[model samples]
Target: MLINEGNTNVFIVTDAVLNKLGIPAKVTDYLDAKNISYHVYDGITPDPTFNVVEEGLRQSIAANCDAIIAIGGGSVIDAAKMIAMSQGNKCKPQQLIGILKARKPSAPLYCVPTTAGTGSEATLGAVISDDKTHQKALSIDPRMVPLAAAIDPIIMKGMPAHITADTGIDVLTHALEAWMSANASVETDYYAASAVKSVMHYLPLAYKDGGNLKAREEMGIAAHYGGIAFNKAGLGYVHAIAHQLGAYYSIPSWSC
Candidate 1:
């Protein structure tokens, strides 16, 4: 099922922790077995900055990557989206903000989420840092959405309790805020309600037993649903305030 004669060099953007934990290595091993050429850039930090995006972009361009496969949490995937699309646009990540009116389409992108939150794989928005202004800016464009998402529950079994809790909360926040947003539609409401129900039913089990595949799957599905809901309905004060907190304290968005 390798597409385009397997000439697409998949650029995997991830964090050092996941790389050290061997997730990227395992994925690379599989890709190698399938004779798919790929490269891994594990330099993306938590709450990534524009500089980090630029670094990944440089590597991707040098590798002549035709596609991107992000294999970590939201930060890694967010950075990958920027890297995947930056090849077509010369502007910096910050300057590409405010609805992404300036960006052109780029290579196909895929996401493999190791964590069951953030839902960056399903969304079209990426938050990049503006170092000069000490603020975070949103890059919003349908072109930023990944062409496919691989939601593997086995990969999420390694998440610690705190990560599970925080990400679960993030999912809840996304659903509720989306449901109540002024832009909410019937389609979004259905997805939001389903996400809320799944989080309430499975988050505690996933937190208590990280290896529970059922709970992990539910959370992962809920996260994706929440992402889809919010992408259409938009988020409210919670996300806006959280963005400010991330910018003000240099904290990760999930932490807020």
Candidate 2:
């Protein structure tokens, strides 16, 4: 779907684990069949730092990639957003931090979320950590939103139980925070409610049986809905404090 948007050379962004596992072959194989040019940069860490973004941007620029595709969880997606935006603006990733900092929209960005959590693919924000301090900085721009995403359950079927549980709780947190925000409205309420209900029901089934395609699909949708809800309605203290603590301690959200 992304290549159909007229992108020629592509830059594939992901973590070392996913790259080593050869999970990106899911997309690369298709690209190969279609004769699309692409380069894979798999240096993203769990909490990506500005250095990581810089390295990715450098590689993508050197490869002359016109499009960016993220194929991992939240951290990978976030890094891809910054990489695309920086490449589009012809600047460093650190310079793009903060609200509405970009002079133009990001380069065409697409996502294949291997984990049904964080929903970074659906949102307009990306968080990049400081190289030395590990403190997170959020960049918000409508341009940061991906052009498209694939939430294939087959891709998620290999996720371990612990990650599934952790990400499911993250989905629930996003929905609840959005619903409770003072900025929430009728439109946000619909998405938030749907996500909350789906997580409450399908999370357990997905956790119990990773091969349950129906459960995986529902959770994936729920995570996307939660992201949309929060994107519009906003989030609260849970995210406010959790983000800092997670960045500070190098832990993921909901681990405590």
Candidate 3:
């Protein structure tokens, strides 16, 4: 399917933890079976910085990869967005930090999120942190959304309990804020309500038993719905304050 879309040579973006855990093998193993040409960049860190995206871009360029696939959580996906946009524009990742900074389309990007958090695959914005200061900058462009996203429960089944709980709350928060936003429309309200309903019912089950595939899949959908809702209706103070807290404490934004 990717090949039909002109993704002949692919670059995979992931993080060290997921790489070490071999979680990305779910996709890589399939690629191997298909004899697809690809390269893996496992340098993405929590709250990835411009330096991280730059290195990923360098590796992708060196490999002559024509497409990009992100596998892992929000940080990895956000970094991949920068890499894809930068590679497509043939520019530095830092140059694409502001809204609508890209003059051209991003590289054809696909995602297989390993965590049910952040909903980055469904969003057009990516956050990149400063290496030293840890301050975050967002880049927004419709082109940044992935061409495809696979929310497989099998891939998310191994997430730790704490992360599951934190991220489930993240989904709920996104939905609640979007529902309450002044920009909320019928479409946003529908998505936000669906997300809230899913989170309220499935989050506890997923947290208590990560192996619950149904719960995992539902939570993933909730996250996606939350992203769609907030992408149109906008977020509120919870995210604003949480983002700053995360930066100050060097914790995951969801945890804040």
Candidate 4:
């Protein structure tokens, strides 16, 4: 339900990498064939700053978009989440930079991930950096979660080895942290274990062969389960330290 078939305007959010790979075109072509009006904001960066969210917001509002669809990996999805969240809250993204700070629900948001990383499509949290200070600010509102997501292996089969390895490791980290969480429940344990097992079996295959659809599918499902586990159980030192590294060094979260 990302876009209505007719007479609907959508703001498509993405990044340069996905645009270069023509991932957004998949969605745009569908929209085009269905006669769904869409505007594209593809300026999102790796660590997504408040400024990037604002520029996207400006374009979205100018277009009077009724829905938003994000197509890419974590950065693109996270930026789109914040843009949608900020729209409904009627405030700057920085204002809602803490636990459940958003006063209103987000605008309609959907995700189509291009990599088996971050699982931003299934999470309640999004991170944005301060344009001025370069420090990371987090927003953890259930409202920010995407309304729906499309996990297609065709989109993920093109990932480079380094990224596949990095994100696969990142997926393992998520499950491990979730399983170790103090708040972890049996529900979280099941998903965490499933994700860990999937990574153990499939990560090497995907890393060695990007075109392996089965491996790509497993990695994507592993990431999704990792997100589900962590969403409830929360994360541990890995994410915290990763955040610090990302803030200080400008490293992407999926980087190992």
Candidate with the greatest lDDT versus the true structure: 2
Q: Please list the residue runs of candidate 3 whose C-alpha ends up more than 4 Å from where it truly belongs after superposition.
A: none
Task: Show the lowest summed lDDT stretch of 10 residues, model 2.
Answer: 247-256
lDDT of 1: 0.86
Please provide TM-scores, in order, for all candidate models, with all chains considered together: 0.95, 0.98, 0.97, 0.96
Tens digit per residue, CA lDDT, model 2, 1-256: 7656888899999998898888999889999998899999999988788989999999999999999999999999999999999999999988888899999889999999999889899999999888788788999999999999999999998899999999999999999999999999999999999999999999999999999999999999999999999999999898888888888988875664
- What do the candidate models score in CA lDDT, each in turn? 0.86, 0.93, 0.92, 0.89
Which 10-residue span in candidate 3 carries the lowest summed lDDT? Answer: 243-252
What tens digits encode model 4's per-residue C-alpha lDDT throughout 53-105? 99999999999998899988888899999999988888888888889888888
Worst 10 residues of 1 by lDDT: 1-10
Per residue, candidate 1 scores C-alpha lDDT tens digits across 1-256 of: 3365355577888899998999888678878887788988999987788999998888888988877888898888888888877765755565667786554785678888998888889999888877667688788899989888888889999999999999999999999999999999999999999999999999999999999999999999999999999999999888888888887788877798
lDDT (C-alpha) at residue 110 in model 4 = 88
Model 4 lDDT, full chain set: 0.89
lDDT of 1 at 101: 59
Pairs of residues clashing in candidate 4: none
Cα lDDT tens digits, model 3, 125-196, are 998887788788899999999999999999899999999998899999999999999999999999999999
Q: Report residue 39 deviation for candidate 4 (angstroms).
A: 0.8
From the highest TM-score down, the ranking of the candidates is 2, 3, 4, 1
